[model samples]
Target: MMHEILRQSLRWAILVTLITALLSILLHAASATLLRGLPLWGGMVVVLIIILVGVVFDMMGIAAAAARECPFHSMASRKIPGARHSIVIIRKADQFSSFCNDVVGDISGIVSGAAGFAVVVALVVSLDFHEGRWLLETLTIGLISALTVGSKALGKTFSIRFANEIIFRLGKLLFILENRFHIRVFNVKNKKKRKRKRGVLRAPRTD
Candidate 1:
């Protein structure tokens, strides 16, 4: 079991690193190409999208952690859409939180910074702004940082407030993928037998 856990960890680490690296390259290349001819506002749009991605996933991490399992159990017993799948994800809350908030969120931050730099370079070259180049670059990077951090800070509050609802909805989406689309992305088998055994042990005496 320990070996299997370690193997899974290593596998996830390698896969995440490769995905982040490839995404970073693609984002940088796309940003450079798209911003080369776009106006300043257009470039800013790309930066905003990156920030949004980071913020959304950060919120998802919080929601996943904060979600209650009892509600999921009720939903699952009632055969609600995605309830069982939600329970599966909620069971591994720590791992899901790390994946959503740390891995994907950090990657988004890196990609955003890269995109910001690309935009800055594009602007400098297109406008031939020799003077105050350092200042312009500083402002651009600073704006990107502010937006990314500030949005996440604000999102944290909302996530905590609406955590259950958010996670419930996410579970529904995962359910659709698993049942209709034939993709069990979370790969968790239902543990109903364990719960049932516990319930039997706790039952009141009928004697």
Candidate 2:
């Protein structure tokens, strides 16, 4: 059992590493292309938007980890669209939280930093202010860092207090994505009995 767990952990680590690298490359390239011709203000706006994405994803990660699965079961009995999805999130909270907090959150942070750099460089070049370039870049990076840290700190507290509600709303969005757009985000299975189920996801564990 220990061996299996070790193997699974290693496997997941490798997979996540590859996924993160590829995603970062794609996102960085896209952001660079988008910022190429945009003005300093426009690039700064894009950077702010990316920071917002990181904050939101961090909130979802913490919320899923803190949410309870029982309440969602009750909602599911009422034929609520998002209730089932919420259960899935709570069941796989560990993985979901890691994905949101580490993968998406980290990617967004990297992209935002690159975007901030672009914005600062554009400002310096546009104003022909070479003398203050270093100082301006330092301030821009500091502001971005402050914003990301401050917002994420606040988000953590808010998400914990309203974990279930946050997960439910996110579940509703996932439900729409799956049903309307035909995306299969989760698989239904019985985590306890190792049996096939329908319309839900199960947490993996050792019995």
Candidate 3:
């Protein structure tokens, strides 16, 4: 059991690193394309959007970590659309949170910072303000940092408070995507599901 846990952890670490890098590259490339030939304000808007994405994903991560599983089971008994789906997410909440918080959230931060640099460059080019380039860079970085940090803090609090509801909403959305659009997100096999049927509200303890 210990060896298996270590193996899974190491494997996840490597995979998450690759996922983060890929997501960062894709987002940066998209940001570059978005900022190309756009006005200064437009560039700023794109940066703000990037920051918003990060905050939202961070909220989802927090919610997943804090969400209880038993509510989902109750919903399932009532034939709710997303109840079973929610259980799948709850089952893999740790991985989901890591994917959201560490992979997408961190990538958003890095890309947004890069986007801020692009914005500063754009401002300098548009205004020809070479004298104030340092000030501009500092202010731009500061503003981005503030917005990202502040919004994430608020999201964390809100998510913790409403984790179950947020997760149920997510499950509903996932159900819609899968059933209506035929997009399978979680391929939850029935492996040992009965054995784990009476699982606790939290994730099952390995030790």
Candidate 4:
């Protein structure tokens, strides 16, 4: 289990780094060109907009993660009959939570790293350049940061949605199995009825 966890962590780290790097490069290029034609104040406004977008995306990612980890669905399955089916449903739900935690942790880490890089870039640009150039640099950094956060948010949302769907399907399957198989593994009514019949049969030849 520890080995599996470590492997998953490594994979997530690498994926997040690659995604963040690619997005940063693309955003840096695009923002650099776009901000070139804008006035200093206009560039600052654009940069702030980008930062706001990043923050929104980050919040969305967190929300989706929270939804994925929620135990409501699992709890609902407890009302289902049949111990075997309930166990399967609960296991699937637990797996969903585990996946959510890993993916969300990686995304959160990426967002933090990207935000730090943006801040550093902003500070450096402010010190190294003046007026329009500094504003343009800040805008570029902000755009890159926004892109990184947005991409992670989108990816996480997709993952969470997919996981939820799987859990739903699993729950449905469990219901079907319970109805069709009538496993009676934990059917209290069936067990009690069988016991009563047995008792009647064994009640001696009182006839």
Best by TM-score: 3
lDDT of each: 0.84, 0.91, 0.91, 0.50
Q: Cα lDDT of model 4 overall?
A: 0.50
Q: Which candidate order results from sorting by TM-score in descending order?
A: 3, 2, 1, 4
* Error in Å for residue 53 of model 1: 0.7
Alpha-carbon TM-score of each model against the true structure = 0.81, 0.89, 0.90, 0.37
User: Which one wins by lDDT: 1 or 3?
Assistant: 3
| Regions of candidate 3 where Cα sits further than 4 Å from its true position | 189-207
**lDDT by residue for model 4 (41-149), tens:** 5555555554544544443333434344345445554663333333343444333333334444344444444444445455556567444665655666566667656
lDDT of 3 by residue, 125-181 (tens): 889999999999999999999999999999999999999999999999999999999
- Per-residue lDDT of 171 in model 3: 92
Rate residue 175 of model 3 by lDDT: 91
lDDT per residue for candidate 2 within 48-139, as digits (tens), equals: 88999999999999999999899988899897988988999998888889888999899999899889988988999889999999999899
Worst 10 residues of 1 by lDDT: 191-200
lDDT of 1 by residue, 128-207 (tens): 99687888889988988999889999999999998888888898899888888888788756546543344456568898
